[model samples]
Target chain A: MTGPTRPAEAVITGAGLAVAGYAGIADLLGPVPADRDGDPLAGLSRRLGRHKDRATRLALLAGGRALADAGRPADDTPVDTGPEAFDRPGGRTGVVASSNYGNLDTVCGTVDAIDAHTYTGASPMLLPSTASNVVASWIAITYGMRGANLTLCNGATSGLDAVHWACHLVRAGRVDSVLVAGVEPGNDAVTGLAGAPAFDGAAAIVVESARVAAGRGAPVRARVGRYARRADLRDAVAAVAPGPVDLWCEPEDGAAEPPVPARHRLEVGAQLGRRSGALGVLQVAAAVAWFGRHPRSRALATCGRGGEASADAAAALVLAAPEDRS
Target chain B: MPGGIAGRGALASTGRTAEDMFAALCAGRSGVDTPRAFDLTRYRTRHAFEIDDRPPGGGDVPMRATGWLLDAIGAALADAELAPDLGDVPVLIGTTLRELRSAELAWRQHTDFDTDRLHFGHALRERFGATTTYTVTNACAASLYVLGLGLDLIESGAAETVVVAGVDTISESTFGLLDRCYPAPPEALRPFDRHRQGMLQGEGAAAVVLRGTGDARHGLLRAVAVNCDAYHPSAPDVAGIAAAIREGQSRAGAKPSDVDLVFLHGTGTELNDQAEALAMAEVFGDTPPLATAIKCMTGHTAGASGLHSLIAGTDCIRTGAVPAITTLQRPMDEAAGLRLVRDTVSGADIDLVQVHSFGFGGLNAVALLERGR
Candidate 1:
């Protein structure tokens, strides 16, 4: 068997978050009430948000916020300088999103229409939204990201896997940076399938190579450290955390006990709702916030599909605080 | 670059094995027929490339797509002389609609199936002993996208062996959408033809095993490049396709002149064909590489189409025979100067092959494969 290799280090430059009853990532660290909020897509233009579903809209809001936070253009404003116009950062920016139930509402609705009115009754406009990658596609289209675009519909670990693939893209030299978003909506259809109330928001992070972040003068919040996926949770934890950690963002429905001990433990799902696909990104965002308060402290975020069988893969990643606090 | 392809498998209306499928293609056999899986009485045209025979397992499966996927994986493992259980090896799946058809069946017929099956990881873990699995749904280009990820996993030394598969059954909802979008269903799918009509849906699964430190029985994966058009949702972008082709070739350390054959993503749609032709012209200039479209016989397999082309391209390299697009009577005006394969060419000198997959949402992926030494 081939052992896992330590990938090149990437830095998290920006983060965007939207959760019910919470204002920002800082709020996630402490306790918050369970209250509903207004429409997340209230300010988006009708032209851009014409036929989008709830998950897509939430992803757009969070993705646009992250891009803006990174000091990059958030919307698809045409740059008409010359042939080298696309040579800007947007040209090399890619998007990777994770959403297990992103398009369930659209799919169920379309299927219901087919059952009632046959083939002719299905709306052509809503058909494209049924694809699971619609969220990532919309984010790329809105931001004009022409790099490698991907969407992960993997099970519970999808959010962390999306982040892993984003880092993979940067390390492989495929793209300069990647916009990673994890979104899931608690619509009736999704709730029915999940048999539980889902989180109705998105979390996004901008992960770029350290060299690119330095070149572009972007502030590095945290450095992406070792990442590993193993059949067992203990192996994953051991692989990622060879050294001690300051904070551990434990998976909401993960193992009953912590695999690796940390100074402090934070249950993201307890503070926020059961975010499903958005859980991993939210965990990383909380870690970034913690690093901001305590410099040079390391954090480990772990996630997995909980089970006794070894087939239930677990993933873990280390996040180190930036060296220069200034 | 990714590791070599140790084994490959396929399940389509054309055939179950790659050899059988390629033989049917060379003999000019078509798999398109009237739909038998679902009712199509109210539709204007009722035709799809439906598979009649059940997979290796019984037909009484909760999710037909899962059954096909398991069968394909089994076949791939057997071909590679590996065990049925994948153990800790990672499995990467690509599908446009994962168990959505099963959910539709439940909604329509009140069939009882576990909702957790919607996410394929549960079934994959239970049946194949896969510890890590990634499922990607990037429209029709989903399979190639996952294949690219599988390559990265092996190249990065994250795993020694990886299983990559793509499967999509007929989604009644998607079928209905296509029925309303197209003017009328043509008799057959004639991709890249002058009088080609829109494409018909097809259902199937394809899989390949990549091993970093083992004998590559099939061929070597040179490179895979993926990009989003970021343009219109349904329209194919020429720049995106050209960029993917150029990036794939550049990653493989090959020039435009080095490519011997190209498997076009000819979906028999007006916009798709026009855009693909323009992209080829932009990349290869006046005289492009010898090209062929497998959708003429297999129909458009949607998400599984990319792997279908990749497997067929591997077979072409092994046999030195390129199948003909029998449905192509005349090339389109834009592709007139292109060398579209007409008849099956035997003993042809082919070393490097390129495959193209473009899907809705303007997702584009290209892969290059070299002949196994």
Candidate 2:
């Protein structure tokens, strides 16, 4: 594993989060009505339609608040296809968004459609949006970042992975700035399957290279110290015999041990969310919640999801971003 | 000198090694066979080069195709001359399915289950004691993407050595879904041909051992970059392709003027051919470097395509030549402005070749591999 180290260029200038245990997480859940349209065309008015899903609303609210806390524009004018957008303080900004269970409302609606006797009525765009990358796609479209954008889905590691990759992009000079958004919305589909173990919420951080943050006179919120992931879930499960019997036995491989000791010290939610995607989002939200409290504190966050046998993990170290008043 | 093939393993219909697959290609033999993994009764395309089952308990290969990947990884470890104690080695796997078929089969036999229980990443890390690992699942580009990640790990001093592999096997869910999407049954996938209809999905696994500057005896990773189109969901923008090409060439310290051969993505889909051909023509002009497609031999191996092409490029370097684009029967109009490698032989020693992977959600990755000095 690489040592806990921060890249030279990347600095977490601003961080904002909304989680169940954290204050403002519930209010920001917004208003997501059960009966909503599946395929609404993108428009000035339709943009508000996304508010129906608490995830998007919380994402915007938290993201808006983060930008506000950093003294940036409350609403970053969309930087669509122009050198002008890249020239702005956050214009050339790139994004790495994560949602373990991205757009759960879309997933539920799609599943409901598929399960419904009337398959023809199902929305075509629903399936596409239900994909893991949709949140990143939505963010890029919303923010107008034409640079490197990725939505990683590896159980709970989604958020930390996003931040980890963001650090790399900044260090490698891929993007001037990055918006790492870890979002999970309140949806019955997710809550129904695995019960809402962790409160649904969203967290976003504006990251930039130290030089870029200083150049723009932005306040540095935190610094990413190190990041790593151990995907040793295959052996985590007990091995089972082949044929039609013993289907539920975990693999018995000795190497299935987790890289980090089990998280018995932490206070976990009531339910073990079934969806790897959801657990990832919750972990990210939790990390964001933790980071919010300890602005300058060096913190380590790990999010993981295990199957009947397999387990996936993503980990990151968050530290206070150094201040430089030029 | 370019490091010789230090470690290689492959699972295909012929049940062969890296050497065997190469020999088969040289002799003009293909492993394409009848599809037996699922009920293809309702479809017109009932053919696939399938691997027979091997028991899982070190007996017969129970999961014949999937086991091939595990065996290939083992073979790579053996080839690298590394002991079974690979605790320090960082492992990265690229696959779209995540053993989806295995999980699906398990689910069908018994309901209410988490299908990811059979994830390949978990399997490899557990058996090999891999330290750091991640699964890259971006459709067909998964393999190459993982390979690129492995290179990054090595280049950044993340690991002394990185094992990168890509694998996918024929699954009923994928097959049935693709069948429903495009009903051109059992038709051989043909790329850059005007008459090309659609794509045929196939399964296989391949792995490579990438080492940093410390191990000259192993191999050198030239340069690999994963880029996104930032545009549409499925189509590759001309600008995105140009950017990826430029990025690969720049990272490899080669200019467009220095590239020797260009290995096309060639998914055999009509739209893919048009987009890739346009991109190639724009960058390399009329005399684009000797270009060929390998997907014809392997079908659309999805996660395995990127690594498979990388392996093919290595084979090209080792053999002092480029492989032919297996099934391009006719020249399509879209490829008219570009140089297409066809029915020809060349002694042109390609110092640097670019492997292209344009996949789901506009993932356009171009990996540059050179004859390591």
Candidate 3:
């Protein structure tokens, strides 16, 4: 009843990010920006355009940078399918991005659409891009990726879970590589006024099976050795049942080990603008930065919020390759 | 699927009793009538599949649209034989608009909007009084998505049991929104028909009890996966639907042949039917299993369709008989090779059924439900 110890093929090869304090991994390790009293989305206020919302902008920018970082094109192109598709390391690339407030722009538009009829206002373009999934499709269409594209919306865990699932996809041989990103723009009038804390950022990583990344000569950043979901950790206690405990340790060799990094303290009062979906990006940014500094360190992203008070979730181990593996 | 509705109840236009509703559906009776739920008299089209009622607790009742939800939740608890005091069990309610009723009230009274009280997420926690609760407002697919979330919680040992609910009642805001965008013909809902105009806005509430695996008689909730097409918000990526079907089947530890039937999210809309048909064909090819939708019978109940279909499909497997599509005289040519269950097939062993629900955010959710072992 045992499958191959695949070693979690979903490893990060490259990452690209754009956010408030620092652009890319620089901001992750650098000093975080101070939260202003009245201003939210302080880092991204100047970048908003009439057409694209904050989420889409982060997606496009980060996606473009990630692809560029991986040496892929930014624009869509007509390509012949078959073995040649696999020959190109990025051909089988899929996109998985998560965001808390998908298209706040569209939500506002729907409100305007209703208001337009009420007050005889202007007719807004009720574009499908406004929906959360549009970012995924936009990536697929733009990149000509005929592989899986998914958007996970588990609030702060969206980015983390998307990366987790993206890793699974690679392990399952659904795709050779995946572009997993989490983006959130500052909330508009509705989300802003309704107490959605302003968060602005996008983080993406190029993930591939270790074998595939090795085959393509891509640099491997980390190998996610193990991932586990824990619940209700606020009490500093986990309701460890025999069965879940077994599943958690199923793939482990001998020791029943706790998977988080050493010498790490959980920080509170962390504020990101309304892009809660970018929480994964935050986690990745922090982990990658930690790796960049400490080199051999592994990190874990843990959180639980939004009504399910007792629901505790911690994506345990984020491990990087040994320094010489590069 | 995983946990059958051990106890369940529903409130629809045809009445709350299973017998009354099933009998009416069998007789090809349509519960759709004049657009009373919403004031659609201003627009050219003024028709809907509406339900007008409310739950037991008293409050400044908004339009009687979401009333069926209360009854449905209560009935589900009763069916599951669950105690009203669920204690620590989680509650996940899927809705397109939990505040539409309040919004209607506010608009009617010319009052300022209160987002906190009217938000679906907050409202669900208040209504259910659960220790843990969250709202999945992913448009039409909200119900199924919530169900999937509940399944995740159970699988991950987050909760011993979870009550998942989906509810959307007819409202002036929805009607107005649909009227402006989607144009439905003033008649019966016809899924897969070439002449299909749009979707009929129906209202209902459905709740299911999901229990963890080790529990006694915890039915097999075979497979459930929610994939955001990240396509257009309104339209599902046709290719993504195929990917979902493939992924769902793989997760269920089954093959294409294992699916005995398909309970489609057929709203009788042109875009949806075509997209679904193409997706099904792409996944299962021409020799797919028998496909049908209950929308023609129950109408597009928004968030309620997935759970409703899950209930109906489970019943079909439990009873060894697939219910016929009432009043489906003609099937689409593109839907060839797939048998349309027009006449009720008696004593067929339907071991597995796939239920699909595509929501407004281009969120595609497919759930594979196998008969309880």
Q: Which has the greatest DockQ?
A: 1
Residues A1-326 of candidate 3 have per-residue lDDT tens digits of: 11455443677777777665454565555456563343223333343323555566677667666766765545544353332343343445666777655554454455445554641222323444433455665565555664555665544434556776677667655567888778766655435433566666677777777787777677666666444333322221132111121011101011134332235533311545444556655566556556666764545454433325323233333445436232
What residue runs in model 1 are displaced by over 4 Å at the alpha carbon? A1-8, A78-88, A271-273, A324-326, B53-61
Candidate 2's residue-wise lDDT over B1-373, tens digit each? 1223356666555445766665555444656666765544444566665555533442111243446677778877787787655654766666655544543343233334342333444565456755455554455666776666666666566566778887777654445445544536547777798777777776778888777554533234567766655455455566666666776676777777777777889977877888888878777876677888866666777777777777777667667666666677787987987667665344767667788976665666788777655
lDDT of 1 by residue, A151-240 (tens): 887766778889988998988766889999999887887766666767788889999988888898998988888787666668788777
Superposed Cα deviation of residue B77, candidate 1 (Å):
1.8
lDDT of 1 by residue, B1-373 (tens): 5478998899899998877888897788888888766666757666789777644543223488888888888888889888878766888888898888877666656678666576678777777877677778888998888888888878887778999998888877777788878877677788888888788889888999998635578988888988888777788888788888988898788999999999999988889999999889889997688999999889888888899999999988888889888889988998887789999888988999999998888899999999877
Ten-residue region with minimum lDDT total, candidate 2 chain B: B55-64
Candidate structures ordered by lDDT, highest first? 1, 3, 2
Fnat of all models, as shown: 0.63, 0.09, 0.07
lDDT of each: 0.81, 0.57, 0.60
lDDT of 3: 0.60
Assess every candidate by TM-score: 0.94, 0.77, 0.72
- lDDT, residue A160, candidate 1: 86
Best by TM-score: 1
Worst 10 residues of 1 chain A by lDDT: A78-87
